[model samples]
Target: MLTFYSEGSRLRQARTELHDGALVTPFECPERLDLVLKQLRQSGLGEIRTPNAYGLAPVQAVHDKDYVTFLANCWTEWVSAGHKGEAIPNIWPARTLRGDRIPRAISGQLGYYALAAETSISEGTFEAAMASKDVALGAVEHTLKTGEPSFGLCRPPGHHAAYDQFGGYCFFNNAAIAAQRALDSGMGRVAILDVDFHHGNGTQQIFYQRDDVLFISLHGDPEVTFPYYSGYADEHGQGQGEGFNVNYPMPPGTSVATWMAALDQALARIHAAKCECLIVSLGVDIFVDDPISEFTFSSEDFTLLGKRLAHAGLPSVFLMEGGYAVEAIGVNVVNVLQGFKQSME
Candidate 1:
């Protein structure tokens, strides 16, 4: 399980996140990556390597060009507009408002492109996002080349982003970008299994109308979860992608047994799809102690989850997503990798 990481992730140092009604420190801070990296080194799971530069082409593949341009220039535009503090959206185009037009004002633009108000943009957000996608692309290359599992320790987790919208502490959809790269590299089919606490809305949106790539996610039910849209049991794929997209949305305090049952069903769907490659949107936020999410998974349960994915026997790429429990995130993440490695042995 080779791990791909980038020091550039340190540059995204936004200090504000809107939760409930007040601004507080972001749960998706840089320390999460530091702890995970430390555990990988101490556990001797595999070598931690810096990712190669893949540039914006791979990012543009899954994200809109204008959206990518907005992310790159958002911070600068906000600063130039004389706004104080990190860039956060206060307004959005709701159902009756005009969403087809792009706003000239930076504030309006922020709302126009943002899906939620929790994430803020700072000085180095664009650079760091670029590097994060590079890390994901590097893992895709490693998995394709070696036919072995690899991990992309991506910061600014990206499952919540869409083709043209950014939010949920994510600017660019790393897992979606990686899946597109895999398809571009001549693979017939690829399946993404998102075991994150929140639904992978962006990844599902990207492949929802396509049959070449299958998207599946098991997460907290959107009825009461963070992303309060999509992630329902009946929102199956449309047209050519019918029956390809799967969602197993469970309630809060979902037992490990129930979650594992959903995992078994997801795995069966993946196997039936005959996918040539597998990408796991790995998130440890489902841990019992996580601040922002609710689930009952323990550290040992993560190990079992990893082993189950390994048993599926497809070339795997693991992309890091949400996990705010700074103290135990390392152990839980490493447990998954170690379990997969040990299972392979």
Candidate 2:
């Protein structure tokens, strides 16, 4: 299990975020990735390597070009506009609002391109996002070349981002971009299983209307969770993508038993799809102590989840996503990979 990482991920660290109407230190901080790396080294899972630059082309495959450009320039635009703090959205297009119209002002563009205000764009945001994107694509390339599994240590987790909107501390949809690159590289069929506590709304949106990639997520019920739209069980896909998208929305306080049951079902669906490769949006936020999430999974439960995923018998790419329990994140994440490696033996 090769781990792909970048020091550039530290660049997007925002000072604060608007949570519960009060500005507080962001839950998605660079320290989270640091802890994970520390654990990977302590465990000696595999060699840590810097990623090859895949550039914006692979990212553009799954994201809107204008949105990418906006991410690249938004920080400078915000600074030039005389804003001294991190750039957070003050407004968003709502019902009856014209979303099709692109705004010229930095303020309107911030609101237009941002899915929510929780993710504040800082100075190194675009740089960090590009680094994360390269990490994911590099893992995909490595997996293709070696026919082995690789882990993408992406920061500012990406499941909450959409094709054109950024949120949930994510700018570029790293997993979606990697899946797209895999398909383009001639992997016949790929299955993206998002085991994040939050539904992969962005990944779902990117592949919702397509059939080549099968997206499955097991997360908190969207009715009460963040990203309050589009994670319901009823959204099974549309048109050519019908029956390809699967969502298992479990209620809060769900136990590991219930979560693993959902994983079994998702794996079954993936196997039925004849998936040639697997992309796991590995999020440890489901841990019982995770600050912003509400699932009761114990650390051992993650090992169990990894064991089940290993049984899927497909080339896998594990991309880091959300997990606010900074203290235990590394242990929990490494538990999954270690368990998977042990199972293979």
lDDT of each: 0.92, 0.91
Compared with the true structure, model 2 gives a TM-score of: 0.99
Kindly list the per-residue Cα lDDT of model 1 for residues 66-182, writing each as its tens digit: 999998888889989999899999899999999888889999999999999999998899998988998999999999988989999998888988999999999999999999999
Score candidate 2 by lDDT.
0.91
Give per-model TM-scores. 0.99, 0.99
lDDT of 2 by residue, 1-345 (tens): 899999988988789798999999999999998899999999999999999887889888988999999999999999999998889889888787988888999999999998888889888999999999889988888988887988999986788889999999888999999899889989877999999889999999999898999999999999999888879999989898999999999999998898898899999999999999999999999999999999998888888888899989988999999888999999999999988888877
In candidate 2, what residue range of length 10 has the lowest lDDT sum? 91-100
Highest lDDT scorer? 1
Candidate 1 to truth, TM: 0.99
The true-versus-predicted C-alpha distance at residue 277 of model 1, in Å, is 0.4
> Which stretches of candidate 1 lie above 4 Å from their native place?
none
